[model samples]
Target: MNIKSILAKPFAKTVVAKIYRQSNNAVKVQQNLMQKLLSQAAHTAFGKDHNFSEIKSYEDFKKEVPICDYEALKPYVERVVNGEKDVLWKGQPLYFAKTSGTTSGIKYIPLTKESMPTHISGAKNALLHYIDETQNADFLGGKMIFLQGSPELGDTNGIKTGRLSGISAHYVPKYLMKNRLPSWETNCIEDWETKVEAVIDETIHENMTLIGGIPSWVQMYFERIVERTGKKVGEVFPNFNLFVYGGVNYEPYRNKFEDLIGRKVDAIELYPASEGFISYQDSQDENGMLLLVNNGIFYEFIPSEEFFDENPTRISIANVEVGVNYVIILNTNAGLWGYNIGDTVEFVSLNPPRIVVTGRIKHFISAFGEHVIGKEVERAINSQTENTSISINEFTVAPQITPVAGLPYHEWFIEFENEPEDLMVFAQKIDESLQQQNTYYFDLISGKVLQPLKITVIEKGGFNNYMKSVGKLGGQNKVPRLSNDRKIADELSKFQQK
Candidate 1:
């Protein structure tokens, strides 16, 4: 066995056993974690302001700290940026994860020493779990690539700042250094199109065994590889067997991905954000990611339906129920208090606290009082297209309030690899599936308030073109599956078929 795999086997055994123990006692562990976080930060600036010392329970916490998005927390973040110590966390943040925000412009999320290791360990444990289950560690000996942001960091105030993926680039385990590619020079290229070309140049002949990234960007890389070699990815790298992805759902792109690789491969999903590494897929046989309950963050949930209410019903992780959609909130060791990162989730298995990301709280179609989420659209399309030759490249949904004729409808803009034989039939099937899942949508259609959803075909390369036009072409940028407004739909109209 290779050195990495040999060391991994025993380590995986020990860690997996510990994980089982922790998960079996999830409620107790989470409660303990919450207390620990409160104790640790009880002396910080934010702690004093919020009266964290007197808060002895989750109820007290909810009353003490108001739930906040980046904007709400911006005042404290501004203090941190001005070189204030012990403001958010205990000391100066180790790094600021710089991300573009729509309304707020540039946002800088804190990453402290206390919370950084979880990001690395979360990813590591996922791979170890896969190895433990499948006894397949052969990929360790071959090159692995994670198509990420430019590793070249910029300075903000006195702290290093970059994309979360870029910040993570500096923390790759020493053991995998020899097997990781492309080189630092290629990784530091600022422009994405240039970087992809450099990556292709550097690793075209390497035995690439594993590929990781957001599926859309990785698909671009894979397409370039195929174009260069005139062969499927599997033909070029026969041992490439694992695809690890996050940031967006992979179901819509699965058929196209498998087609590009010329075969099916094992895949792992991760739930990560600039705020923290929340969860990772723990088993190849499982459908959902195992929530990292014992990690450095304490989680809270609010029912998605009540999210915009004046006083939403906030509950601790202990009270979360299966099959209910929730907007996840974070109170982390990094000093974020009652932070809402905006993603929604649904618990599928509460035994070990496994969850499927349902959608974003703000990213949905609620026009006409039909609260249609990303998961519904994804499920609708996947159910109809599965086992058929109709493969979607990308798609998004938006409400069409004022059609030239007839009632308003939900418009699906799809970029297809292979169009269905009957477009009307395909649209009907998806609309039927959606109606069955969402009662509000069903009522709208049944009551003649809205017409059945319509499909608008986007020309090939249209989505990519739109992304490029927005200057968010690659690396963690993904099109929201559905939106309440026509902002994206109006932009995509430029590429729609006549």
Candidate 2:
């Protein structure tokens, strides 16, 4: 047996045991984690301001600290950015994970020494659990390519600043470093197109067993590899049995990805963000990702129905019920207290507390009281596309409130790898599918309050060009699948014009 196989035997056994123990008592684990985080940050500026030291229970913590969004946390983040020690966390942050902002040009989320382990260890344990469950240790014998952002980190106020993936790349375990592809020089190339090309050049001939990336970019890399080698991914890397992905929903891209690989591979989904590592897909038995309860981050859930209320109800893991869409809140060792991360999720199981990411709070469309979410929209598209041979490259939906010469309607901008024979028929099917899913949407169309959905066939690479123009071309960047406003729709128009 190989060294990896030998090592994985013991490691996988340990992780499997831990998973069982944790799953059995997730609520207790989460409670203890919250207490530990609060204790660690008690003396920090934010903690002191919130009386964290005296806050002894979840109820007390909830009463003391108000839920805040990025805007509400901006001042404290700025203080940390200006080299203030113990402002949010215990010390100055080691780095800032920069992300596209909702209210501002960019958001700088602090990545502290205390919180870094949550990202690294959580990711490692996820894979370990997968191996434990599958008994698949041969993957460790070959290289694993992670298509991440540039490893060349930029400095902001004496602290490193970059994409969360880039920061995490700096800390890959030394042993696995041997099996990782793309030299540090190639990883730091900055431009995504150039970086992808370099990655393909370096990894095409290697003994690759695993590939991890945001599905869209990985698809681009796969396309390039196919072009160069004149072979499907399975032919090039027959040992490749795993595809690890997150950051965006994979359902829409599932068909195309499998086609590129020439067969379906085992996939592991992760719920990682600039703020913290939240969850991961632990077992192939279920679709929901297992929440990382014992991780450094403490989680709170506010029901999406109550999220917009002046006094929204924030509930702990003990009280959260299955099937309720909740906007996630975090109180992390990184010193964020009751901070709303903007994403909405629904619990699929309460015993182990597995969750499915439902949508983003900012990415919903309620333009005419027909509340439509990302999950609903994606389901509609998936249902419509599953019946046809067409494959989607990328898509985004927006409300066209003021069309030049027609009633207001929901517009879809789509780029297809295999175009349908009849575009109008395809569009009608999507609209009908959506109506079947959302009663509010169905009522709007039936009441003649809205016109039929409009479809715009974007040229290949239109979304990428749009993201590039807005300086958000790669890494965790993705177009909002659905939007109430026309910001994304307007930008896509500019790309079409060019």
Candidate 3:
């Protein structure tokens, strides 16, 4: 056993606190930790499989551990679909968090016990930072209503076979066995409808003060509140102090929610996923402080140029510069040594580098926080699109709120070879594939959290013209890997006009 691992016993919080205190920028501390992890993780994750434990130098780690999409992780996932374990790691993975990756298909991200605390502690620290910033001790004193996943703890076909944020939410705490307050723990919500109802009933008239979660979902919960009680949102919950959300951009969804509630949205950013809380916005003015779980993950940054570099490799975070985008490389506890997270981000500052996520490294749209990536989207469309002879040369997706205003839906601009006999039906199939793969998408739609889906079938050669305008029609860059909402859609529309 690697004795160096013991320093991580308390998930390295003191070290993080120390880093926070001593370092002027996050760069110095990050490099120090990487130097330690690069040497140690090789032994910690040794001999798990070809997929796990492949770290030599930080550069080798980046090259060898190729970027993975959800579909790429499917073979390991099929085992979870069949209730098998030890495939993703040496030991049994306690639960799986179903993240709807950039793909229209699902990415079931596995969260093991070792890496879970970092997630929970990061979350707690985020909250602590919030309280510190706001100077509100009562934030946690009142009922903390998190508009999040199913309040289930045990595993019973729980997101094992299918996609569900509720199920994924359930696994988060269990994986981080230490962070949770055991006495405060509740029942495993096996039934979806019942679980939601329970969550609703629990929060409705109670002293639900500190509200947290995605703005869209919080709006969904607000709708549920409005639906269950004839009273407008304001009359029911006058005590609500704050709202927290992440996953999707909040600017568009904010005004509508505020109008109904008779309150300005006091929203905060969260960098959470099915795997863990990767980062969190610490203060009102500051960008999200990357609480590097120094013990749990070894960090590496690949130059944004590395995407075009013939000899691309991961570089130390110590050496990264602000304003440059880099593909995030992670060497985490769950036997994943020197892994590239496939997401892209940039540092706002070097001293405790506050990172703002630019987008996915590989093309993928996370219109929702489902963590969708290029391959999963491609896989979902390729087999079916190819069979139908509707050759999808290229595409872009944006969250269009026009259908129901606050309730957004994925708007697809398809460049198809042939027009479908039943275009609506074709769109339905696409929606079905996505919904089946990503349960969270289905949940929001079915629950009326979002609007009815819309598909805009564009004219042939739309993508080519679109690419040309971007001045990246040919080489490594074709079009964006992902587009979130109206901004990208408008750009695409302008190109279409040309």
Residue 268 shift from truth in candidate 2, angstroms: 0.7
lDDT comparing candidate 2 with the true structure: 0.87
- The candidate that wins on lDDT is 1
In model 3, what lDDT does residue 35 have? 53
Per-residue CA lDDT of candidate 3, range 300-399, in tens?
Answer: 6777546657667557766777877778766555544445566677788666657877667655545565445443444455445643435443466777
Candidate 2 stretches with Cα past 4 Å from truth are 494-498
By TM-score, rank the candidates, best first. 1, 2, 3
What would you estimate as the lDDT of candidate 1?
0.92
Which scores greater on lDDT, model 1 or model 3?
A: 1
Give me the candidate number with maximum TM-score. Answer: 1
Please list the residue runs of candidate 3 whose C-alpha ends up more than 4 Å from where it truly belongs after superposition: 1-19, 22-25, 35-90, 100-108, 151-198, 227-234, 289-295, 303-310, 362-498
Residue 68 Cα positional deviation in candidate 2, in Å, after optimal superposition: 0.7
Task: Write down the lDDT of every candidate, Cα atoms only.
Answer: 0.92, 0.87, 0.56
Candidate 2 worst ten-residue window by lDDT: 489-498
lDDT of 1 by residue, 1-498 (tens): 678878878888889889878887888998899889988888899999999899888889889999999999999999998899999889899999999888788999999999899889889888988888888888898999999998888888889999999999999999899999989999988778888999999888999999999999999999999999999999999999999999898898999999999999999998889999999999989879999988898999999999999999999888999999999999998889999999999999888899999999999998889999999999999998888889988999999999999999999999998899999999999999999999999999999999999999999889999999998888889999989999999999999977
Lowest-lDDT window of 10 residues in candidate 1?
1-10
